[model samples]
Target chain A: MKLKILKSYLNESIQHVSKAISSRTTIPILSGIKLDASPNGLTLTASDTDISIQSFIPAETDGKQIIQLSEKGSIVLPAKFFVEIIRKLPAEDVEIEVRPPFQATLRSGTSEIQMVGLDPEEYPHLPKVEERKVISIASDLLKTMIRQTSFAVSTSETTPILTGVLWTLTNNELKLVSCDRHRLAQRETPMETVGEQQFGNIVISGKTLNELNKILPDQNTLVDIVVSDNQVLFKLDNLLFYSRILDGTYPDTSKLIPQNFQTELVLNTKQLVDSIDRAYLLSREDKTNIVKLVMQDQGSVEISSSSTELGKVTETIPVSRVSGDLLRISFNSKYMLDALKVIDSEQIHLGFTGSMSPIIIQPEGDTKILQLILPYRTTN
Target chain B: MKLKILKSYLNESIQHVSKAISSRTTIPILSGIKLDASPNGLTLTASDTDISIQSFIPAETDGKQIIQLSEKGSIVLPAKFFVEIIRKLPAEDVEIEVRPPFQATLRSGTSEIQMVGLDPEEYPHLPKVEERKVISIASDLLKTMIRQTSFAVSTSETTPILTGVLWTLTNNELKLVSCDRHRLAQRETPMETVGEQQFGNIVISGKTLNELNKILPDQNTLVDIVVSDNQVLFKLDNLLFYSRILDGTYPDTSKLIPQNFQTELVLNTKQLVDSIDRAYLLSREDKTNIVKLVMQDQGSVEISSSSTELGKVTETIPVSRVSGDLLRISFNSKYMLDALKVIDSEQIHLGFTGSMSPIIIQPEGDTKILQLILPYRTTN
Candidate 1:
């Protein structure tokens, strides 16, 4: 491709596509990012086997010329070097020219870089998705949902499906759920959907969602999502992200939530987080990450953790409200801290059926989202 | 020890001493920070074999109570846990009490931590330095000298003495030098000395100096330094740093720098840095970190680097002045970048003796500091 493009525009698009270029790609051609220049603009694409990202730059943006094209052509440059070179280019405008035998030259101010480029035709084409079930959600809302639930996904690859967050659309509402055996996170929000259109059991890798979150707009804008049988596509303003869906049925988690609680407590979210965070410090030393919480007769909760070599940390925080049977529960403090951190509420409610059962936590006055952690069975 | 201390004061002191408590410390008692509380103040000390740092928090500072001593005693608490706990404590004031058998309880807000304290007597004492010949220098200047020279210290342990920066003081001039075979960095500044007080051959570990740099006052206050037979002591406002000097003699690098140049060029430091930085990126890809600089006939220099697999990057920068002889030299771009980054000058002069000799770099009009790098032999 022969074109002169603004450094800022090219740098932004390169950063977007670079996210899809994983170092683990075994195919040599897949390690490169493909560039296609046309009469309209320039398109940059980067992909591994699992996910692909493409960003487009128009000939002009907001009445300012961003690109001047001399010829329409295509070539693939190594993502690792190209990404860094563009960022460090010494001028506002960069001129890129491709010669025969796939050699590319990039010139910016006093710097010129000649790189060996690969044939764009050899790079794999992006998967085509049927746009029948296109759904749109606000970018910031989607980012928040990803942040809330994605951390709970199983990091282990043994059960690959469990490594993804399950996405389900029903009754004009979009819900996301992720569980990693020890803890589960779920979030739901209302959306305007076309008449009676509904789909479920679409699972996308938590890691992919995280990368997608980074590319999402910082401002509140809508992002359209298209789900195919085996692939999913997220279309933002000028960028497109495509990923393969996990091919397995997600476990039924509806029954995992306890319908009633024998014990319940409500406290300021920051105070509770502070109390448990201290316990987590000592718990992390023991390597079990176990922190214990016990209800007090004087309407307070005692949060504590002990290490065989380091002794113990005990935190006493008064509860705003308390009811049901007295109980003592132990759990992974790291998991709880992760869950509590995403909570936006000033106060949170905790529900427990018993010591060993799952403890349900919900933001105060918010019924659409919750987090659950399975308590550890401690002899004490 | 029983005391109520302001968390901010205690936290700052803890951070200063914590630098001496290395995780690699083999002695259990050395891993703990020794705390001595007296009517005057609370003293926090941490020591590894090579270095020891002590911070004293007075009972009152500037008419405000920083430490309220209830009883005078001493104890040693595990540095790893105490450092983190104090930082995350829930209150501005932290109360610490030591009971019989060396059990300590720390109370802050609603949080309480019970730690097993080691016997203070078991902790190794800090080295005693002879304070007969004490000289003082600006803390910021010492910090700057450390930053400029420390990075060149040999990281490899095969030559243990080379891991230290050599310090020489004579006629009110304090100079620091470090060399790791490939390149050498030297920085010198004049300080007021009392009656011919001079010391040379005092070498301190670069790692220890780095730790000291972190604890040095951000303001440009003077730090009294005492160089003893085997230890160097640095006295800050309320902090004391004692470091053991390397036993072996440091190699003389004075002869390595050329007294005259075959070719010389002067250019804007930032522009030269940017040009070479881009070349360094490509040089880094080749893993040799080799970037070549060639003097042009038309008052300019060319910076370039290449990889067999990735191609080449060339930058041509115009120089303001050129004199002596024409030359083409190659050196480690990373070393050049490190040396150039510490030059606080708008323009810098480059002096080259020949294609095979060391290239010297100095900030324009500054003779107090200089950097030297050996040229690499390359067939082109």
Candidate 2:
């Protein structure tokens, strides 16, 4: 394979795909990125069994020749070192030529590097999924959905299915749910799709979701998501991201969500978030990172945490209202903070059933997002 | 102790001294910052045995009222936790009150923290040096002197004295020298002093010098350097830094630096540095990080590195002249890069004796700084 590409454009494409390349995996071929040259453009593919990423640099970009294909072929090169070399090359243009017997030469101005390449055939092939059962969503909305709920997924391998955020799609709305038993985060967004076939639970790993989120540039571009029996694909303009779905049934979490609360309060989201964050610093090193929220007799919420070794901390934020026996509940401040970060409404409503019951938090104006935290019984 | 200090001013002073507090140190009391309140201001000090830093927050700064001290007393509090709490406090002014039994109350707006404090007498006192045998130099220049030579100090503790930079005052100049046997960096700057003593030498640990450098803050203010029999103190404004001097004598490195060379070339410092940086990437994983330079006959320098397992990289940089016969030399690229970073001049002069001799690099117009790197004898 022989090609000429602009250094900047080529470096960016290489870096985007390099995130999927495995550094210390058992499969040595997965550590390299596959380069394929064709009449249309040059495609780079990198994968680590769990997720595969493919980025294409078109032959022409904005009237500038990004990649010129002299000979069409494929070769796999070390992902990290190749990207670093391209970034540091002195010239604006880079020339890559792959010779027979697995040897590739990269040159830019006066700098030249000869690296041993692996046959592209040795690399694992990404599973190809038919596009019949596909749904489209705005890339920006998809990224937001992933970021809002993915953090709540359990990282433990004990229940492999819990490590992935479950995606449930109806005819018009797409729902994303993730929970780690202690807390739950759920987000729903509008989707444009044809046909009314129910796509049951497909647990896509949170790790792959995060990686795809970073690769998708923040824009309003639409992405087609195709789901097969065990593999899923996200297809963007000239990039394709594929991942294997966990093969287990996700636990039904609907029953755990509270249907009613004795008291509810609405307050400015940013103000409440800042107060909670400041209170968090006092108990960050504790095992559960628990902080107590006291519903005062007056219209104020008192946040407090105490450690036997380190002393106690107390902070207060004025709330809109208070009722129902002045309840005090303790929960992980980090989880609450994470939930607060994803809320979009200017005002947030928090509902409490009792001291030990799970609390519900939702953006005041949005019915699509819900956050639930299991409360810990606090004496004071 | 009782005082009220502006959040911004207190935060800065606490940060300046906290650099000397090591959270994982064996000495428990060393992890705390000693705080003293006086009628004039409040003082904060933290130390980790190797280095001690003390900074005073005066009653006023830049037309802003900072501290209001009502009582005079001292106590020690956990440095890391206290600094973080001060940084994130909600209010603009923080009120601190210490009561009997060593309990400190910190109040910032609606936030209140009650932390257990240690007796100030338990904290180790920094050695006080007399100001009579002191010299004054520009703080910026002193920082530069530390940066230029500190990286060359030996990190290995096999030779404890070599881990410190040797500081010598003579001929109205303050000279700093550091070497790890493979390379050496030296710099000298003029200073004003009162003592007529011809010579004095003190080896200050590189670690201590680095911590002191961070607190110096970019300024042209005069910094007083007081050298005593056991400790060295740096006083600038309301901040004082004390460091223990290494007991053993440092070897004389003056003779190791060549007085003359057979080949001399003047080149743009940035260009050479950039080329070396690019070439260094190819040899990063090698034990010696060896990169070779071949002075071509036709005003060009060839930089190359090869690995048996990995591939080979070669690049050439065009130069002004080639004085002597074609010469080849190899050395650690990291050492060369470190030396290049310390040079501030745009143009530099490189002097070489032969293929195996040490190479001397210095700025074109300044005799104050000189760097030497030992050549590696390569078989290739």
Candidate with best DockQ: 1
Provide the TM-score for each candidate, comma-separated: 0.99, 0.97
Off by over 4 Å in 1: none
Q: In order, what DockQ does each candidate have? A: 0.88, 0.73
Error of 2 at A375 (Å): 2.2
Which lDDT tens digits does candidate 2 get at residues A286-307? Answer: 6657898888878888888877
> What does candidate 2's lDDT look like per residue over B87-164, in tens digits?
988889999999997899999988889888999988887787876678888888889999999999999999999999
Q: What is candidate 1's fraction of native contacts?
A: 0.90
In angstroms, the error of model 2 at B318 is 0.8
What lDDT does candidate 1 reach at residue B371?
A: 92
Per-residue alpha-carbon lDDT of candidate 1 for residues B282-311, written as tens digits (9 for 90 to 100):
889889999999888898899999998998
Best by TM-score: 1
Docking class of 2: medium
